[model samples]
Target: MTVVKFLRLPENVDLPLPSYATPGAAGMDLRACLPDGDVILDPGCIALVPTGFAVEIPSGTEMQIRPRSGLAVRHGLMIPNSPGTVDEDYRGSVKVALLNAGKEPFTIGHGDRIAQAVIAPILKPQIVEVDTLSETERGSGGFGSTGVKE
Candidate 1:
């Protein structure tokens, strides 16, 4: 197997923590910095918390903002927009939008690890607008049209 690595740094006023990523992996520690490192979100609720940093990602690449699998499965907690796209051109502080789908509130305290981010390559395409487009096998089929039963 091959490995890909890219250098990243926290922008001004943003501190980068020691990453504990294993071989061939990229990881960064995120702190909640809220009460007890927990931010409580009620059912059907949403909360946006700073990631305590900003980044200068290189062009032709992107960062995926995904929720911790453990948090999602165990607490019904997740990023409202799973796999949130962080465009390399964006220079603002990164924030996570968390929502609670469970029946109770979930708390995120200060220094509590909230989400995990993965950096990956991105492809840039030139715009070519057309009046018509090609169709697919299931053209315009609505959701669930694929099938409900096996």
Candidate 2:
């Protein structure tokens, strides 16, 4: 298993570290580190919620920050950039950008599970310039080219 090192900010020392909710969970739950009052997110508004922790991910891997399904379904909360990438070299505080899509305003309290992070290997493929390219059956089909009932 790949290990990730985390540094808790002084102000958020009382907060719990990120943890997997279940044995088969693929990502670890990240909590909101708000020291002040709750964040009130108006409909169609976006907020950068801090996690107050910096992570040291192993080389060749990245941490993907994703929205929690429950929050998305129940509160219409979403991560604008779903699966936000945290490069291995990043050592700054982790923050999740949340967008409220619901009609009603939503409140985010401190220690609320705002997002999840998954550590996965990254592939860096070499780029090459070629005059000719191969063609396939689905080449340049674009959106909706494949039938919906496939």
Candidate 3:
């Protein structure tokens, strides 16, 4: 298990730190830290909700903020940039940008689970320029070049 050190802002003392909902869960639930109560998000609108916590992510790893499955299926809420990355060098409060796609306005209350944080390993590969590349059967095929097959 990787160790992630966190700092809770003064205004977020009442809020719980992000945690895995289940023993086998791959990500931890990140909660909203609204200082002014509930926030209404209209259809096609986006809001950057603060998580009230700053993290010191270990080197060689990154924290990816992702949309929750339940919110997407039930409320049509999603992260504008899915899997938003928090690099190891960042030391600011973690936030999630949520977009409301549903017809009705969605209310985001304080301490509500808004997103999930997934810690993943990062790999930096050295770049090398090549004159020509090997070709495959589906070479130069873009988009639906490969038809759906069962």
Best by lDDT: 2
Ranking by lDDT: 2, 3, 1
Clashing pairs in 3: none
Total backbone collisions for each predicted model: 11, 0, 0
Candidates ranked by TM-score: 2, 3, 1
Instruction: Compose the digit string of candidate 3's lDDT tens values, residues 28-49.
Output: 9999999879999999999999
lDDT per residue (tens digit) for residues 38-118 in model 2? 999999999999998999999999999999999999999999999899999999999999999989999999999999999
lDDT values, one for every candidate = 0.70, 0.94, 0.94
lDDT of 1 by residue, 67-140 (tens): 87778899888888888877887877677888898788887766667787777888768989899889999998
Q: For candidate 2, what is the total of clashing residue pairs?
A: 0
Worst 10 residues of 1 by lDDT: 3-12
TM-score of each: 0.73, 0.96, 0.96
> Candidate 2: minimum summed lDDT over ten consecutive residues — where?
8-17
Model 1 steric clash total: 11
Clashing pairs in 2: none
Name the regions of candidate 1 deviating beyond 4 angstroms: 1-29, 35-38
Q: Cα RMSD (Å) between model 2 and the true structure?
A: 1.0
